[model samples]
Target: MSRRTPYFFLLPAIVFLAWFMVVPALQIFYYSFLNYSVFSASTFVGMENYRRLFADVNFWWTLLNSFLFILVTPVLMFLSLVLALCVRNLQRGTKLFRTFYFLPVITPIVIAGIIWRWIFAEDTGIANYFLSLLSIPNVHWLTEYPTTIISIMLVTIWRGAGYYMMIFLAGLALIPKEVEEASLIDGATIFQQTFHILIPLLKPTLIFIFVISSTAAIKIFTEIYIMIPGAPMANKALVSFLYQQAFERFDLGYGSAVGVVLFLITLSFSYVNIKLIEQRG
Candidate 1:
């Protein structure tokens, strides 16, 4: 009955969030404290799951992998920004180019992973086939430790950068044209205008992209699951390993614990990013 009716309109979404996101997350935490099994009923187990997690070498490897992915965000940010700038400066076909670039972001991850697996194959894959014509030996891309990680990282960058580029392009477009004109009138070099004007104004968009990309990077599973598949000596990311433990091994407790740890690490980074963005603003 009141003029503040939008609050009532939003109530259903709030309820849905609580029912789905909030409740499932709390259940994951509770299950992490239990001895859960796919083949049997769960029993209370205190922090044993978490203790086992801390002592596991694979867990540490995954943690390191997660951090390594965070490092990728800056590289992606630069690529996205560069592409956005290029598109912004273009006078023709910008829409067509944007659609082509962002197609991977919308493609199903399973399909993308499968396609990449073939391309990365050592001998017969198109990538190595062409390389061999130039006399480069076929590289075992997915069977090696660091190389496997590197291959996954490369694919991740290719698949993700365009979406962020679009986001950045939108942010860049919203900047007042007169501000840029003023900079040009004052004889600001392109580098000076970008570093001093564009970046500072895009801080909010940057923070949003960072949080989204960092979280998505940590949860990387589809590619590793499709490509690596327990290849001996290859260090898979933590999420893929957790999938093996939970669904493959039926060790639900440990898997849920790993998920909890991943969530906490992501949350910490998101919080720090928010604070840094606020300070800069």
Candidate 2:
């Protein structure tokens, strides 16, 4: 085989990455330093956009909201691992259960959001109807402050858990049966086996899921956009804030600044997670 064969095979992927990922990232970075709005002429005002972004109180709030939203990651990870473990040992109907759980993952986020929005509707929604049966007042799921954020988090968990479950299932499959049998022979409880053997072995998979889910939580926009259409202050996520600034308000430079900050945050989180996992290992 020619030494150049590997490069030939990699060329397509390299070109795709350069075009789709690298180029767009560079453009966003460049735009973050300028006063580029959709309606006006572009002018380079180095650091001004960043300065403005730092000074904006709402931007800081959005950042806080983004971090708060990431609280869903733990819930997602826990549920996914549990479900994966449950289905991993199933002797029958395993495929059916997996398909049922994963249906929400393949469902369009827009459609999911719409369905959830109606389900949680303030007046006539199913949630309130159930509450009414219990003599409780109609709880505002989306319009309320923390509840609005919580609603989105719940939707995120519902959509993401099964997807991550598949990752855990694959990791579980890679775990040697001999080790499990040895643990069983040693009279280890399921909990003990999971904690001592399964979890330790699944570290890499856990870290990957953590990073991916954290990033997804931070960059959450579509669900918020569709579920809470007008983006009330109580429910606004960082990406939703950026969308309003860039598309709705036409402040592209500021929006790009937000994007850069979001990128840095996600990168930092992923790095820290991987480092922590490595240190633990």
Query: Which predicted model would earn the best TM-score?
Result: 2
What tens digits encode model 2's per-residue C-alpha lDDT throughout 138-193? Answer: 88898877788899999999999899999999989999999999998999998999
Q: Candidate 1 lDDT, tens digit per residue, 1-281?
A: 89779889999999999999999989988889989897888899999999998998888887787677767788898999999988998999999999999899898888888899999988679989988989999888878777888888888888988999999998998999999989989999999999999998898889888888888888888877788886642277878768878988899998999989888988897788878877875
Prediction 1 global C-alpha lDDT: 0.86
- Could you tell me which 10 consecutive residues in candidate 2 have the lowest summed lDDT? 228-237
Model 2 TM-score on a 0 to 1 scale? 0.92
Q: List residue ranges in candidate 1 displaced over 4 A.
A: 1-15, 232-234
- How many residue pairs in model 2 have overlapping backbones? 0
Instruction: For candidate 2, give the lDDT.
Output: 0.91
Give all TM-scores, in the order shown. Answer: 0.91, 0.92
How many Å off is the CA of 259 in candidate 2?
0.9
lDDT of each: 0.86, 0.91
Clashing pairs in 2: none
